[model samples]
Target: MSLQFDIDAVLDRLATDGWVVIPHAMPAALTAELRDACLQVWQQGLFHEAATGRGDGQARRAEIRSDSVLWLDKVATLPAVAAYNAAMDDIMQAVNRGLYLGLAELESHFAVYPEGAFYKKHLDRFRDDDARTLTTVFYLNEAWPQDAGGEIRLYLDADCTQHIDVTPEAGTLVLFLSDRFWHEVLPATQQRLSVTGWYRRRGGSVPW
Candidate 1:
């Protein structure tokens, strides 16, 4: 099916469920470009396992290298990425109403989790940083399955008790309020690739 870019419908669902999936929001060709970019970065030996040096960081068995602003500089400037970002901007505007300004940073992340690699439950946004309002994730795998195991589980409450599980499907775009939700990337029985990032409101920067 062709991707549908329904900003209002998606925003409405996000407000209610704390998360929404815009299936195939990305074009097949763009998805291929992103996948190729991620693979190229991997070949350059720039990938590394995500290490937080804390007990809470043990779930992810894959590697992660940041500095996406640089990686996306080349990709985002491409006609395909520019068009996608424009669509995302429209969605952001619909959510924030007339207060939408501009993106603080566009992070390009490549996640490669082999079988058993997973990210434990965590929130993308910190309580101290309110500038980060929206988090977006794009799947790169072509034909992900329901049992693929690399799904994102998003908490639906403040207590992190109730939750919803989202399968990682190619060309799928998932977005939600960054700070208001807690989520995790489950272990995959096979290799998984994706580009995940956030759109922030104008604000002072936070130390990572």
Candidate 2:
């Protein structure tokens, strides 16, 4: 099934607040299939420890981040993965039309956070690169309990004085300005699953 969301509402929210979270952005069937595919790759030990920075600066820093990741192909053979790509493409076009963001492409990955894993606060865009225009994270953990513990903490102010915690629930999609938000993942008590990605403009910098 195709993904569904309100473009007007999402655009309005982004313009007003710089970020928005949509519950049930994807259908249940699609969410389940994508979750299955993610688990299949994870069980096969295909994911690698997530690293920070780009190129020579890139290195695994367990002190800052402890999750694993498996990037998705731009054109995926898996039906569920293909559907997700299409959905994101739709969103990219809508955003460009509404906000004139000039978004041209998306790079995404399946991320798994093991028990007690966390990522420290950081901006999605690198200091040297500005191609990343928007950040999107789609959660696939079904029936997430209140105590699951892995929540994206979005810092709302430059001084980090205000914030919001977003639960990683199935079929939920969160979007925000890549260069604007300072966010982190709280340590999880159990495994956490999601697809994380960024939309890029035509010519700011190469992707890491």
Candidate 3:
């Protein structure tokens, strides 16, 4: 059974730790469905090599990141994508109500990190614009072995002195402040499947 969403617990963690990981945040059946969708889309050749930066300033640099991505549209008719976005709507409402974050919109995409793929440590907010206020990564890989690595490292400071490494287990949700934390995906021995997204504030360039 899917566990109920715990808004208070999530909010408390965000306030104190600046990040949180919720196990079983999503239903197993939904995750399986989404995983199938990801594979299907990938087979359809819809995913692209992910790029960095924002707006006109973006470019692909393999050294910085090496994941393939397929962005999800809120209005998409795809059942998996549309259902996921609808669930996020309630969460966003709760976040804005509890924290007054002024988040105006959200964007999400399927990210597939092949074996040996990794992303260099960086904040989610663009340097030229502070529109992205929060970030979320939802894992859809079942039986993710700890030894398979692909763990996400969240640095506690600007210099990476203290940090936490999290396994990308199926149904796991990682949430953090976009500009306040520096994080990265470590090279994985196995493929990693996830949906990464951001909540943006007003006046931010639409995160298409």
Candidate 4:
């Protein structure tokens, strides 16, 4: 069955549950292209191990690189990524009540985790700043297994306790409030590939 994109419904759900999962926001071919692009970057030795200092003795790994305007521009030239971005813009606009007027700055990055690699509990938004209002994660694995781990666990409270875990599914788009939500990625049994970034309001920006 084909998937539907419902911005209002998703925003409502996110407001209530602190997150929302929208299936197939991208086409299969486009997803493959983005995945390949990320892999190319990884193979070229462009990524580094992600920093982990906020956890309580939990093992994890992640690599983050910014300056995605060029990367996103390249991907946007492709029909699929462009279409997905357009749809995403609409959803983001709806979520922010149209505060996203004018061109939206899109930041993109490739997150890869090999076996036993994971990201501990953390928040996407900066403590001293609140410009990043929305965050999006696009899964690129073709058939991600639930048991393979690398699922994102979003905390419901300030102490990082009580939460919901989400499996990384290809063609699936997950969006949430960046500043208010706390989350983490579990270690993966196999390599996990994904593109994650945020849509901001262009003020009080924090480079990360």
Best by TM-score: 2
| lDDT of each residue in 142-178, candidate 3, tens digit only | 9998799999999998788999999999999899999
Q: Work out the TM-score per prediction.
A: 0.77, 0.96, 0.94, 0.76
Give lDDT for model 3: 0.87
lDDT of 2 at 62: 100
Descending-TM-score candidate ranking: 2, 3, 1, 4
lDDT values of the candidates? 0.69, 0.93, 0.87, 0.68
Question: CA shift at 150, candidate 4, in angstroms?
Answer: 0.7
Q: Model 2 residue 124 lDDT? A: 94
Per-prediction CA RMSD (Å)? 4.9, 1.4, 2.1, 5.7
The deviation in Å at residue 136 for candidate 3 is: 0.5
After aligning candidate 1 to the native by TM-score, how far in Å is the CA of 60 from where it should be?
A: 10
Q: Candidate 1: TM-score?
A: 0.77
lDDT winner: 2
Give residue 191's lDDT in candidate 1 (0 to 100).
76
* lDDT by residue (tens digit), candidate 1, 90-207: 6666667733435455554566665677777777765455556678888888888777788888888999889888788888888887878888887788878877777777763554
Which residue pairs of candidate 3 clash? Answer: none
In model 4, the clashing pairs are 50-62
